[model samples]
Target: MISKWNYLPLSPEQDAIKKKLVRELSLSPVLCELLVQRGVTSITEAKKFFHPQLSDLHDPFIMNDMDKAVERLDRAMGGKEKILIYGDYDVDGTTAVALVYKFLRNFYSNIDYYIPDRYDEGYGISKKSIDFASENDFKLIIALDCGIKAIEKVAYAKSKGIDFIICDHHMPDEDLPDAVAVLDPKRTDSAYPYSHLSGCGVGFKFMQGFAINNDIEIKKYLYPLLDLMAVSIASDIVPITGENRILAYHGLKQLNTCPSLGLQSIIHLCGLKNRELTISDIVFKIGPRINASGRMQSGKEAVDLLISKDMEGAKAKSENINQYNEDRKKLDSQITNQANEIILKNCKDLDKRKSIVIYNADWHKGIIGIVASRLTELYYKPAVVLTYSNGLVTGSARSVQGFDIYKAIEYCRDLLENFGGHTYAAGLSLKEENIPHFINRFESYVSENILPTQMSPQLDIDINIEFNEITPSFFRTLKMFNPFGPGNTNPIFCTKNVYDYGTSRLVGRELEHLKLEMVDSRSENIMNGIAFGMHEYNDHIKSHKPFDICYTLEENTHNGASNMQLMIKEIRPSE
Candidate 1:
């Protein structure tokens, strides 16, 4: 893998532009400079950065069927009608189910939820789900994380006199189904200002309006549930700014102080020793365990854990979730190794192909997307991983920045039987025979559109400074950019001259990491570093050449000993 290390390279034109913004805004040079760095060069743009508000959210009634959907839900709650929620089996889907499930459970005792079995039902709303909704006497049905593509199933449910309200964020086709209300910002008719909400966020917003119309206390009832929305936002890789940023910020605050019983148990299980839990903790230490349930079997168990009221129920579910996570780790490693071997041997046109569309009839459909995501990161290209079982072909696609993988698939829609997803990720199905044509045409579309320069990942450097700038206060100041994710990123600082001047050791049994010390008495500060997943380049680093290092400062603690350390991201021989 080619590691990227970016330093803020300045030009005369850029400096002049920065000076102009600094003069016009009457803002601190630091704030103005940062905004200029972000491509905002005037006070009009600066107002947006300095003042963030909830009024920025789009009008709730502007979505295609928002009024009708909210009206149907209001009726269900008022009449004590049995309400059933259906969702798919991923982190986003499960979290969406939890949000809607808990929100409705607050108002009515007749609320219940269902998540499809990954192996048995595959993806999206199924005929079985509609059948169950009708038979159970749930006059009102809410579909989360899916159902935008279920044309036939929605019609089937409508025929049974059940009202369907869809809360999905995927790209929509020209023809919508016959649901009572379809809520997707991706639709052409939607006037929602921000089109990038996680599935759970959409469900939460639906509840936000429902609470307002019903004259319920929204903060007391809804805000505490944001922890689930936060997890879904990170797990689904949604941009974490605007409404999402506010939701995640409040969600972390809630988890740190007062959390749901299920979340509190999982928090203790994950070993988050600090009371200050950020988005990183949720993604790295926790989200995978909740997701492991759906990936291996049924996501219904996860929803059970989220809504479990009794302490014993929460404990048992947490223990099972932890074990599932362990199993996921083992299976993921095996699939990654096996898939890599197959690609190296059989993918002859890899260099020439635009998007990777690989399928194996014998491969496990449950793990193909995970393996496919690994492939995209390795090659820096759009990737599609597919598997076949019972005469049906199901596949998942992941994309790099600046390329819309969903749009690429739309170019070949005629060849597909069913599909739904957003800009960077999507899921689709087809006849087993269409694989070859898909591979050819999809690659042709990518090759024609993606420029060679654009194929390289965009490297963003927050700000650059020498090792002399290292301090506890400097780390403290960087907290202004907290709650980082797709929209906000951790600051990457660069120091040009550093000498390893010691043996570089590869750590871990698989040589998964590198550890080394760089001393520079020639400069004002001294430092130690650990570069994760960089053992592949140890031989080149052992030679005596000064290196440029990019890293984030982190505090290390062990046995009451505490000091600053470097979480080295990348290293390059000095230019």
Candidate 2:
């Protein structure tokens, strides 16, 4: 699909700051320009960005109700009261449960964990879990990744003599639950310095608070839990800035150097043991395998795998989870194809429709979210994929970059039985009969609210650079921007007036990848560029036409030698 190229413009003052940074850091002007674009105007900011330290993490007590949560946990542990760690069934939730449960088990053995069944209880705090805790005589429950919206559930648990300490990162509603302590940085009243923490990050802060209050060194727990935090942050797609960046940076170090037995087993299983793993590896390889367990059968199995102590046990669990991942992939592909066919058949003019909402009663509920996300890639608009579950129409919603899908769904609240989510994604449910009305209402809401520019995909170019600027040292400096994600994204540089140097070819199994050697128009300098899944552009390169390209620089190693190459993002005919 063609995307609009958005070249970011910098002010004269910003240009001066970039020049100063180039001189002070002894870096290329392009690297300095990217740093400036990321808001690193000074040497100190650049240093902090390049070298993220765990000491830079904010005090956990800064979060509202953190102290209370820690104290409650301490009191429960001291009295030998049965405590339960309750979490959702996704990567963030399961990882949060594993992190806290593993850490607490080192000192307290009375604590247990519970992951609600996705099909039986759906997301968040479930009455079934509260009933289990009550039957098991648990006095305290720590809800991870979810519970901010569990007002009625918390009240029910409270009525059953169970206290709740919620560690959620999702935006909370105006009326907070009556839990013993609600630890959410997104709370309007929270004083936490960083609010973009993942659900596992919030749970880690609770552990930090507990350590601080107990006078135990926080590093003892913090260091060991970093891998889990890193995985959670990467999988949950939280903004990798501030404390999240520090956590991911150090966590990745730990993950690469001394991962948990479970992580090591999975890495070995995926044939990624000897190589340095990136955030992409974690997101695509590790995250999916872990999520597959919950998506297929039970998330508790994933939590068990993560917290496994022995290599043998971890490997055994990893093998089983791998099968689930295989099954998940098949279902995902099949459902996505079916959903695409539905969209194609139902909507004759996709551009005219502001939204895409399709329902298949036979669709697997677990794969609908993935299907919805895949649909957005094809249509470049807000998409909702629904399936029948428990006699109700439930589904997931995914939005494009500039749209607030949650608000759009909220606007059709009358048609929905219930719904909740943030700006970009959400979940909703309604009667099967309401599907038509809901789809029409949702489309109308989006058409009225969404800007025309938001309909198409966009590629944001950080700066324009010459082929000569793509040096080995420049690529090395770019590598310092580790653990890239939402906030700190890999910089995309555009080079204009370039043509293929007689080495363009379509590679990959289906010839879906474009590989070419590009030559600059002015200086005739050359660089290799690869555009994955852009085989459609082979003809233009074959014609030897000048084109502008946006891409990111990466170091490619072959035969023990390394050099920089451009990972192309977009290509456009030169004006």
Clash count for candidate 1 is 0
The digit string of per-residue lDDT tens for model 2 on 1-575 reads 66888886789999999999989999888888888888899999999999998888888888899878988888898899999999989999999999999889988999899999988888788899999999999999999999998899999999999999999988787899999999999999988888899999998988888888888877776687899999999998888988999999988998999999988999998888777888988999999999998999999999999999999999999999999999999999999988878878878978688889999999988888899999888778899999888778898999998788988988888888767767888888899999889988998999899988787788888888888777667777789998798888988888998989998899999999998898988777778888999888889888998889998877776767877788998888898
Where's the lowest-lDDT run of ten residues in candidate 2? 468-477
lDDT of 1: 0.78
Worst 10 residues of 1 by lDDT: 48-57
Candidate 1 regions exceeding 4 Å error are 4-32, 38-59, 273-275, 454-458, 500-523, 533-545, 557-563
Q: Quote each prediction's TM-score.
A: 0.90, 0.96
> Model 1: how large is the Cα RMSD against the reference?
3.3
